[model samples]
Target: MTSRAIADIRGAENLDDLYRVFNENHLTAGWHKKRSSLWPEPRTSFQPLNWRYAEAAEAMDRAGAWMSTEDAERRNLLMFNPVDDNDYDTVRTLVCAYQMIKPGEYARTHRHTANAMRLILDAEDGVFTVVNGIKLPMRAGDVLLTPNWHWHSHYNEGAANAYWIDVLDVPLVHRLEPMFCENLPGGHQEVTSVPDPEACPFVFGLERMRAELEQAPARADGTRRHRLDIDAHIPTVAVTYIDMPAGGRMAEPRTTASRILAVLSGAGAAQVGERRFEWTRGDVFCVPSWHAFEVQSASPALLLEVSDEPTLSKLGFFIRDPAQPK
Candidate 1:
């Protein structure tokens, strides 16, 4: 189309008029835009934000008093980004939420195409997640995975409430538009077996993870990290447990990967781009793509980090900023 025709199309007053002009001229709306699709750098609308577990715990207590498993599929509060009208995603390609289950309560069995996992923050004996007929006990510091399309349910048979952090690739699935979900025919599935912890491929038990972390050699900065491929069926996410000693500091180059970190234990401060988040046990935070970030521990800390690095790297979109001298 000519410049004048483009200008006319841009000036269309209504959606119907715009479509009419495009159809008449065999053009797309892309011609009306002045800005180039290609930009100099990565940009994102997601913000760097954090939520304190203390406040979430209080909210959970109030919710438990009024809400029940019968009322909803799960009792959880999302850590939604404070941007635009966004309510479903914590970041661009991932979402994290705090979930709680009261004693004797059961979250019904269901399965979806989106991969999911949980980081137990508070729980006692008798709390378990049954994934595909295997009942796996849930304890604080443990991580349990329920891959895409796997039947899963939660139950709290302990004396006190059970709390945990749930992270999923829901935003990615939503963007790709392959979402599918279904409730179990019955209310719950019968436990067919309880796999031994040593043989169970679906869990990273607390004690076992801790021992592995202790044995893993520390890097030059006195920090240790263990990587796990939590998504076995459809790999889209990666999980890492970082152990930082008191006074340890970690600085990483900016990368084109969105990430969420839940403070599993101890205290630390994170500087993401221009924002600072002081976090302790149970606190959660996000780092948007291409943001420079660093973490410093005031005390020895263990952190559970979830990121979309696998998806980006596999798609050949992953990149890291050039190294700079200190």
Candidate 2:
């Protein structure tokens, strides 16, 4: 199409109009966000955070180490919503503080059963996330996942905090059982990703083991039971990350404890049954207990996930099936 025609298409008035012109495969929820200022009101419901996350983050940031409590009331938060928090009848969810740090700062390494994630918000040159000895490069909006139990740490090697969101399965796990933790035992585990001056073993330099696990899932029920993938070290849940390029779709997995997803950047659409929700950079979403879904992304997306892992770790049941497949 000509530039004029393309421009006109980009300026479509509504989703129907946009879809009519570009088709569902090309339509992005974030497309006309600028021109289409507002959209149908979103459902407002319970939203609360896992108190432990807030406490631990603050405590760590306070003494330049780590926090240890879960009471996250109002203090320095910019604009949060009880409706935006992770509020559930069974699982607890919270989007703790979004801290912006200065240069030359390093957060200590730790592990636990509750899964954790760091969504890079902003940063300059030299920001790095060290997970299991791999010091991966960090860029604004680039997401790095630390599968539960992995010894992970981060440093502002650049000149800023390299902001990120901490989404953990804390509340769900703690309620199910005691959350276990340890300080990597020997400080920060050293990574061997230097010599090449371009390799990222700790980031995405796998050859066999990881592939084997994914190929033949660690469990028969499509979910790993009380089996620890990383030897008998840190007890953590099975973790996954979705780097939805400009536009991508992911088939929801089968799980009982339900699941939660957070928008990392760009824009996207989430199909929960017949209803759809448009999301932005900081928008968060919770997939109901066993609600089959197909995540549609408009721009590059970085969404974090969490579930009742500890319960399953205790040899309890945590399985689910499509209520009524689509």
Best by TM-score: 1
**Candidate 2 vs. true structure, TM-score:** 0.48
Q: Per-residue lDDT of 1-326 in model 2, one digit per residue for the tens? A: 55865776788997677666654345546664437666442222433222222343454367433422113211123223344543323233323344444466565677766655555556788877677776777655444456667777666667544555554556556676867887765455686654332242223222222343355433221221121232232234343444555656766654544455555455777775455777766555656444556777777655555444544645765554545332
lDDT (CA) for every model shown?
0.90, 0.51
Query: Relative to the unseen true structure, what is the C-alpha lDDT of residue 250 in candidate 1, on a scale of 0 to 100?
Result: 88
TM-score of each: 0.91, 0.48
For 288-312, candidate 1 gives per-residue lDDT tens digits of 9988889999999999899999999
Model 2 residue 160 CA deviation (Å) reads 3.5
